[model samples]
Target chain A: MRAATASVAAEVEDLRRRYGAREALAGVSFRVARGEIFGLLGPNGSGKTTLFKILATLLPATGGRVRLLGLDPAREARAIRRRLGVVFQHPGLDPKLTVLENLRHHGHLFGMRGRALAGRALALLGGLGLDDRAHERVETLSGGLARRVELAKALLPRPELLVLDEPSTGLDPGARRGFVAHLDRLRREDGVTVLLTTHLLEEAERCDRVGILDQGRLVALDTPGALKERVGGDVVVVHARDPEALRAGMRNKLGREPALVDGLLRLEHPRAPELVREVMEAFEDEVIAVSFGKPTIEDVFIRLTGRRLREGGPA
Target chain B: MMGLVLPVTTLWWREVVRFGRQRSRVVGAVAQPLVFWLLLGGGLSASFRPPGAPPGTGYLEYFYPGIIALVLLFTAIFATIATVEDRRTGFLQGVLVAPVGPWGIVLGQALGGTTLAVLQGGLFLLLAPALGLAVSPASVAAVLGVMVLVAFGLTGLGLAIAWRMDSTQGFHAIMNLILFPMWLLSGAFFPASGLPAWLEWAMRVNPMTYGVAALRHTLYLEVPVAAGAVPPLGPSLAVMGAFAVLAYLAAVRAAGRKAS
Candidate 1:
């Protein structure tokens, strides 16, 4: 299929960032259509935050171009800032102020004030279901409530583009679900374009499209279904005490080589359960356990990058 | 017109609220200069006697203007620490990404810090009578003018320092390294006389010296002696005013660069 049109809300081409001797972003590129909820999925230190910062005009890109609402982020930064709202990966709410005061301060930064500012803040808090706690200090709120306040602050100005970096990092399951639902409501009801970065697979699935980022490079970009279909077959997992030996035996006996990571052997085949039974028969008591399931986003990630999405070590 | 005023006023109000919230900071801002004024002035007065010191020159009287200058200097210098904190806490990021110009952040912070400095200077003025200094209405206004100038210069310097600093520890070190020499050499605690020739030359180039001199002149009605000859107060005010303008421009540039 042909790619979508390039009339995008945010466009970044070959964006690169260097921190002293280290290169944080190396030739990264992506585009988000207007009013689309786009997700950037990557582990820590994968240049997701750097990309977000560059787009927000908080950090200048060392090389390449970034455009938000068709204006260069570098030269037209003030114009871009006027139209963009950014919620950084870290908690940005002022702890000293109440939730309403925090929103008021955020509005003031954008040249808003008085009764209008108060009314807008109240409306935003009301929309976020946080009006009841508006008078409470941010420090007194729970992590989930604070996150909602941050979101409300970002939405106070009714920005054209919203950039959220790991917005649901420390939230509980219910909070994360509610936050995602709120984002969906914004996209559907208000038509606000959202560009979010997250490491959670389920959160990424909620986006209309996902960009899989690894080592500062976008490895894959597609809808969740497309990404999953790219894996081709059911994921057969063969757990063994010695994966190397089992993988070699499977390669030699069944003429099928599976990807072995740690103690789990993963393979994509037409009849995964049948293959699992055959493998069990071939290995007999040698195989510790065997499991088969549909391919997950994690599987796609490992297939493309040769590393688990949540696994740690080197990128 | 109201739109323009609203944003700046709201930002300024937020800073004021933040200052009020930090109880420890309020105490420190006021207490540091007052203690320094009393202890250092009293100790130095007991130990040394000038050959031709002015009459009715108690330690408090001689050190009062310096203490005021110190109040302005310390308040401005320590305000940079708040900037570093704001950066780490994501408040600075929010400000930078706002629709406002970079100068708004710089000007707002300077204005906030200056207001606090002026308030603290007022407290020092109220404590002046107990410290043997006269506080007439005109004298109070004059002292406020001098404090405003000193606050402007120091806040500009603070903004400049904060622009390049990424950590609180680095900011603290730079503040100590730069401000101590400025205060000591500017004759804030001691008269600049009897120093080595080269040291005197250094003091001549220090902007704080002119601020301290102008403040002393306004507060005590004393003429500032430059190179052993008392220069006119107009020249001293002009010198400090020039530094204030230059520092403000530099601060604005630094803030713009930081936002980038």
Candidate 2:
């Protein structure tokens, strides 16, 4: 039964959600395999939040079908809620409650009690490296530490699927790494399927599979490596004094125009080294700087959406 | 049934714990009403005597039950205000996603508010002797029971409003526009008799009037016959009970809705 159910932990088929006339999720569809970390990557207003709320059973979709753990969210939301753990982007812990109290509250919400509940709460705290701070109120804890408590509370019920929204939003680099390591361990040992939505490219890159969303549509869905590979070669960027003039010159000489994004000349070429050298030498006076490197997830997003992942890129 | 009970009790416990942690709220909800009672009841006692009371009845004594009702009202408002903050802090989101139904969640919150209101009101009841009013154990128990029912209804009314409010400012607007008027016209501040027809009618229709009347009737449990304008104990209790149920259902319905 585990293997059979493990085939698909969550599935969305042509899921569409709208707010009146405005479409938030336009026919978005994807399947999350059990034990895999699947991420929905998008920029602001890209509808990832709308999708997250729908999956969390907080918002009803205007149209389409969503199934979590083989149960429809519309009809069997309570059943889905029982097996699903959610970590919201904002702080969900009650500032007045201690870390242990928050975990205990979460346990009781799921009908766990007595020594069983107490044992589960303590075990989760210990596992999350929060044993020493369990008695401290969440208001007194640091941002990263509070986030860990939130995760521990979510895990109190031992959910089969853990859904997080921008899980590493406020964490520093070290804390972010620690949080990711915990997720990795959970996936490996407990076979828990993790679903998250994020705008950070690095965060998305670490996921097992990522679905890129732009303006309410999923543009590209694949492993980070595969998405980057789709760009197929080095990414060459040219910051010239006159990008239009240089583009014209490059078009005449190289017989191709580089994609102009955020006022920079960008090109994905199989042999970018020769291309960069030739462009620099050919337009030495016009070119200020030339750079080329392997494609990153940001480049993949740019290649697909024709926009920078982060709005308002540097000139 | 056990599954539903856990979430309700857990939510209820959180409400009480949160209220206990905020000492300022205790002073605001309990002490503030006491000051209101002392100032208003004292100021009015020398100038006017309540109509239709026994020969020696003063404004202070007439207003005592009203003050208890005010304590319950104030505590309910303070407790339900947390619902707005819960939404802001994303705590409500966590509860919404839990496996429990809206009925359990709202019941927990309503009961939590009711507990705080009753505790504060009961604390105020301790001052009853200082005012030269004597009460038996039976009257005291009846007063507490009346307080619980009244607080539950008031808290439910507050929840029905707070759940749909996006900001505390909006809630304050509602408190001023609706809640304050409800309290004032409920015969808590003054006697309902000898008023304009419309004002008298407002008090007659206001559900909280029955709550205050019930407190008065139960507080004077020793009185062989009721004074003027105090509704019968049985009918007042019935109204309070019906109001509690309807208000609680409204709160549950509000919880089940998508926030606009």
| RMSD value for candidate 1 | 2.9
**Which ten-residue region of model 2 chain A has the weakest summed lDDT?**
A306-315
* Candidate 1 per-residue lDDT over residues A50-162, each given as its tens digit: 88788778889999888788888778988888889898877888898899888888888887778999999998888888879989889899988889988888898989899
Question: What value does the TM-score of chain B take for model 1?
Answer: 0.91
Local distance difference test, candidate 2: 0.88
Per-residue lDDT value at A276 in model 1: 79
Candidate 2 chain B weakest lDDT stretch, 10 residues:
B224-233
The sequence of per-residue lDDT tens digits that candidate 2 reaches over residues A25-80 is 99999999999999999989999999999888888888788889988887888889
Q: Candidate 2's residue-wise lDDT over B1-260, tens digit each?
A: 77788899999999999999998997799778889888998898888777767768888888888888888888888866889989878998888888988889999999999888888888989998997778899999999999999999999999988887777878777888888888898877888888999999989889999999899888888983434476777998999999999999998889888421
Q: TM per model?
A: 0.94, 0.97
Residues B22-54, candidate 1, lDDT per residue (tens digit)? Answer: 999898988888788768887888766532355
lDDT, candidate 1, at B211: 85
Error of 2 at B217 (Å): 0.2
Where does model 2 exceed 4 Å of error? A1-6, A313-315, B224-227
